[model samples]
Target: MSGGVDSAVAAARAVEAGHEVVGVHLALSRMPGTLRTGSRGCCTIEDSMDARRAAAKLGIPFYVWDFSERFRADVVDDFVAEYAAGRTPNPCMRCNERIKFAALLDKALALGFDAVVTGHYAEVRQGPDGVELHRAAAWAKDQSYVLGVLTAEQLAHSWFPLGATPSKAEVRAEAEARGLSVAAKPDSHDICFIPDGDTRGWLASRVGAEEGAILDRSGERIGTHPGAAAFTVGQRKGLNIGYPSPDGRPRFVLEVRPKTNEVVVGPKEALAISELAGARFSWAGAAPADAASGFDCEVQVRAHADPVPATARLEDGELVIRVEEPIEGVAPGQTAVVYVGTRVVGQCTIDRTVSAVPASR
Candidate 1:
């Protein structure tokens, strides 16, 4: 459990269904006794205690598994490396892919557990081939986008007890009715590790900020930058360029070149990516029969971003996606989750992107 209302209600439902449920809280923090700043970070010392109380009320076994080392190596380190390489990564996706499913699930199965149940707002349905991942009843709270990295095996052994819930408020009410202490606990926000929510400052501590040049689309130096890695695609603020365009239009970060320590800026329209591809990817359930060939699918870059109409295909070793409706502010290392209707097909870590706007302008 996450020491939140959603997971507490999920555990209550599982116990009410007469299943032998065990509440496992993962200790992912490297530092001991890390406390939650309001509802910022999760899986802290305070959260573990809350999880224990919820488990006690539900009459289930509770254990705290220390996966701090693995989490640091996989999620935290990878996040820093990606940003240093001028790529934007979603740490939650990496945690779900590597730590939660791969590490936690493997350990659970070895301990004779049938599956890992969580409070994620998603659904797993039994399809003809196997279990398929789908969005929850409430589209606003659907978390299937983040769970897109689960493979067929992972999907088979996963359960989302809060999938059918009408709303988050109802989950809180259920937790209160069950006398769970976490009924009023707020949800975690931003990156859990960075409790303060200052991403650029956090990265600067590790990446080491250095003065660099900011260039325009035509390779003309327009301004100076503190560090190229600190900026992301489509960023307008904190550039410190102090220069307006000839047309008086605000310039947006079009690219970041860590190799040369250069930040490229252009018009906002240039942020739209025509296509993106990645070599590292996995299917949520069964691979599409037409995956190697070509098939139409909806592509989502960010967790809350709207899905766009697209055509995807596996070419050589990469998953190439061409969106009919262009996606803006896309950066390498971000995941592109593909979907067929409400079912999650797969997701890939974006390795490269092609700007929709032509360079001739």
Candidate 2:
């Protein structure tokens, strides 16, 4: 339940629907000390206790499952590896893909459960063809972007009780009406493993810093940085480069070349990308029939970002997205979610980007 108002109210709704619901809280860290920080993170001991209390209030059985080993191997290790390869990754999506839907759902099914339910703000509906994933009614809280990794089989066995809710405030109100203590619990904002949200600091400790040169588009050594892996595409702050352009224009990170150990910086125009190629593509339901010829859709690169008009196609085992308008800040290893109207079509891990400026690198 994540010990949040959304999940508590979701559990209440499930109970009111007359389904047998059991609350399962994932213990994602082996070290108890890691969870001592409490509700600031999803996997905290305080969260587990709050989930237990909510389960008690709902009169449902509760259990804490230890998935720490698998989580570290899959989510944590993948995050480190992606950064080391000079790509920024969304670990939450990885967790949903590898741990929650794959591992947890498999175990739940083996235990005779029909479906795995969560409080995610996304919808799963039975369409004419099959199951389809859609954005939540609450547009601001829509999480279909992260859930895009789910395959058709996984989507078939998933339920989101809070998907139809109009807003998070309504969920909190429902929790209060249900007499749940976590009605006012703050939402977990930081990455679960990264309690303090210091991603750069945490990454530096794991991936040791290596001094590298920051080169301008013209191959001039404009500055130096601690490591290429520490920066992301389109990043403007913390470059520590004292020099400014002759025209006084600010420079932004255009690329991180891990193999060359170089951080490439340039003017903002260099970040304008028009196309993206991605690997590890997964469809929520059925693969589009015209996938090879390209179909019109909207592409979302980051969670909470606006979806842009685009043409998406699968070619030679890779998904290619061509946006109608050039966008900025697209980075490798990030997910590119595709949608037709409000229905989630599919997603893939961005592998390469084609920018309007040749010097973008």
Candidate 3:
């Protein structure tokens, strides 16, 4: 439990189902103050306390597992490195992929635990071949996109007690009825490691800010940026360009080059991307038999972004995705979660992209 309503309710349901349950809250931060308060970030001292109280109410054993070092190495350092390489990465996805499922699940299995149960809003179903991951019943509260990283083995040993719940409101209500104190606790947001919500400021301190040139689509230098690593593709607020576009349109960040310390800005239309591909990939449960022959699917990049119709196939040891419509502001380092109907089939960390708009145009 994150000392939140969802996880507390999830644990309550697990215990209610007549299974022996243990409430394990991960201590992910060595320095707790770095975790912000007031609905911004999680893993705080207050959150742990809340979790312990909920466990006491549920009459289960509660323990705080120290995963600080592993979390820092896998999620925190990876975030810094990805930003320094000028790629926008989702640290939550990395946490789910590396720490939560891989490291945590591995440890749980070694301890003879059947599965690592959590409060994620996703479903696990027994398929004909094996267990498969699917979206929650409600699309609005579905989180299968992040859980898309789970392999067949991981899915087999995972449980989401609240997956079939209708809505978050109902979870909160259940928590309240169960006498759980965290029934109304605000959901966490932003990067947990960053105390404040200012990501660019936090990155500048670690990556070491240095001035860099901001160029337009036609290779025209328009302005300078405080740091190349601080900007991400699709960002529009902080460009600080001196002049406006000829058509008086707002320009978005098209690219960031950390090697040369350059930020590329262009009209929003140039952000349209036709294709994305990645070398690092994994399937949810079963690999598509026709993956080499190309198969129809849907791709989602962000946590809440709508899925787009696409075709996926393996080519030269990479997962290549071709979307039916143009995707805007797609950059390298984002994970593309592919779906066939409601089930999560596979995912890939995007390594490259092909733009729909020509450079000169």
Candidate 4:
């Protein structure tokens, strides 16, 4: 449990279902602060106490597992490496994929647990073919995108007690009705590691500032930036370009060339992407027979992003996606989650993109 209302109520629901649930809170940071930052981010000492209290109220055994070492090595290091390589990564997805499902689940199974339960707002159902992952009933709070990295084996041993909830408000109310103290706690926002939420500042501290030239689409130097790692595709603000566009329109970041230490900016139209290729593909359940050929599916690039109509196929050990309508700001290292209707079919970490501009591809 994360010491939040969602997890508290989820534990309650699990208890009510007659399962002997033991609450285990992950200590993700070795040096967590004693005070809460009022931002509701995880790994606080207060959160650990709150989780203990919830477990006490539920009358279940509780323990804090120290996974800080593995988390830092996998999620934190991967985040830094992705940014240094000029790719935008979703660390939450990485956490779910590496820490929660892989490491934690393996530990739990070794301890004779049949499954690992969490408070995630996603569904796992047994279909005729096999297990399938689906979006939560609460569309706004659905977290199927982050859970897309789960393979078929992981999904078989996962449970989400709050997946069928109508809304987050209902979950909070359930927590209140159950006498849980965290009913009104705010939802966690921003990256947990960067408490101040200054990603650029945090990155600069680790990667250091490498002064570089900011170029336009035609490779003409327009300005200078502290580093290419600070910029991301589709970014508009903080360009600091001295002059206005020739067409008197605003410009956006089109690319970040880390090898060249170049930040490429251009009109928003230059950010349009029609195709994407990704590596490290994993299917949530059984791979579809037509996966080798092209199959129609909805592709989601970011968490909470709208799924776009697309054709997906596995070619030469890579997942290639061709969207019916061009998507903007697709960056490498972001996950490309594929779905057929509401069920999560597969996902892959994006490696590259094909822009609308033929020359750029």
Candidate 5:
């Protein structure tokens, strides 16, 4: 529990369900923690104290385990490198993949705990076939998309006590009815590592500024950008360029060229993509037989984005997804999570893309 209303309510529900429960607050940083009043970032000192208070209220043994080094290396460093490699990265998914499931789960198992529980609003059910991941009862807060990277082993040992709950409002009401002190606390939504939500500035500071030239489709210098790390594939604002296209058309980022220290921009259509490839593949409950074995699935290339119809196949132990409905501005270094109904089938880190071309071209 993070000392927040949702987690507090989750713990309470677990207790009500007559299961043995333990509360763990991850001490992800040695630096001062974040504010419950400030932007919705996690791991602040006040937040930790809040969590401890909630755990105390529940009469459960709560402990804070430090995972600073692991978080920095797995989530932070990976975020920087992904941007430097000209791909947009989702740090939340990275944390969920490496920290929550891998690091924290490993620790829980080593300590003899049968399972670990979190406040994520997603559901798990045991059907005739087997355990399955499902969309939370709350569609608005559904997090199964980000969690699609979990292996079947991890899913089996994990519990999302708040998964079936419908909303933050409902959770808060439960907390209040139960008289938990954290009933009024808000949710944390920003990337925990980039506290201020200024991802470009944070990334530039960590990776060092490398000024770059902005180019058009033909590789002609169109403008200058502050740094290659400061931009993403679909960004339209903050270009800071004064020139207009010869056709007097608006522009959008076409690509980031880290090797050449360049930002590529052009007409909006330049951003459309049809196919994506990913590595570091993780499947929920099954494995693909071969490259020819295709499964109909919904693929999410970005968090909170609408699911796009896609078909996935295995190639060299990687997932290659062909989006049936072409998606615009798909970014590499982000996760491509595949789902069959509510169950997460698999996920991978996008490595390459194929764009849509105009028929006239």
Candidate 6:
């Protein structure tokens, strides 16, 4: 429990189902303590106290596990490096895959727990073959995309109590009815490490600023940005360039070259990506037998992006996908999640992308 309404209600539901539940809180070192000014991120010292209070109200044991070192090595460092390389990395997915499932799950099993549990908005159902991961009933809040990195084995030993629940408001109501302490705590936002929402600023503090040139499609220098690390693919609003097209067209970021420290801008059409190559794949269900051949399914390249019609076919040790509908702003190092309806079938890291271009005159 993160000392939030969803997790508090999740524990209550688990208890109602007659399962002995123990609350585990991951103490990520990057989290700033409450004494630190403006530290509102989850996993902070204050949040842990709230979680402990909730566990007490539920009459269960709660302890904070120190995974700070592992989290820094696995999640935080990887996030910084991926951004530096001009790829949009999903740190949540990495936390699920490496820290939560691998590290935390193993520790849970060793401690005699049958399975690790979370308040995530997703579901796991067992069939004759094995367990399967599915989207939560709350479509808008479904987090199956980030949890898609779970292995078949992990899925078999996991439980999500809020899988069938509705909005967090309902969760808070349930908690209030039960008199839980965390009924009114706000939800945590993205990138728990950077609480102020200044990703570029935080990166600059860690990696010294190096100015770079901004370029157009034909490699013509048009403007300048603070640093290539400060920008990302598909950004348009913060280019800081006064250059406007003769026809009053707007410019958008199309590329970031770490090699020469250049940010590229062009018309919005340059953002289209037709094909994607993903590595480090993990199948939520059984690996598709015909994956090497081909399989038709819906794929999502970003967390909130809708699933688009696509085909997942393995080739040359990567998942090469052709999205039927072109989705803009796809970037390397983001996750590509495949699903059949509500069930997550597989996922992979986006290694490359190809978009359609207009024919030369």
> What stretches of model 1 exceed 4 Å from their correct place?
32-36
Best by TM-score: 3
Question: Any idea how many clashes model 5 has?
Answer: 4
Deviation in angstroms for 32 in model 2?
A: 3.0
lDDT of 1: 0.90
Please, what are the lDDT tens digits per residue for candidate 2 over residues 239-281? 9998787779999998899998999889898999999988789
- lDDT on C-alpha atoms for all candidate structures: 0.90, 0.91, 0.91, 0.89, 0.81, 0.84
**Model 4 off-target regions past 4 Å?**
33-36, 358-361
- Whole-structure CA lDDT of model 3: 0.91
Which parts of model 3 have CA positions greater than 4 angstroms off? none
- Point out where model 2 deviates above 4 Å: none
CA error at residue 50 for candidate 6, angstroms:
1.0
Which residue pairs clash within candidate 2? none
| TM-score (all chains, Cα) for each model | 0.97, 0.97, 0.98, 0.97, 0.94, 0.95
Ranking by lDDT: 3, 2, 1, 4, 6, 5
What digit string (tens of lDDT, one per residue) describes model 5 on residues 259-294? 889988888876788888887788776554443588
Which pairs of residues collide in model 5?
A: 3-51, 33-44, 33-45, 34-44
Candidate 4 lDDT, 1-361, residue by residue in tens? 8787788888899899999899999888876452235545776777888889999999999999988889889998899999999999998999999999999999999999988888899999997789999999998999999999999999999999999999999998889899999999988767888767788998999877789999987899999999889888899998899899999899899889999999988888778899999878999999988999889999999887999999999999899999999999898889999999999999999999998875353
Clashes of 6: 0
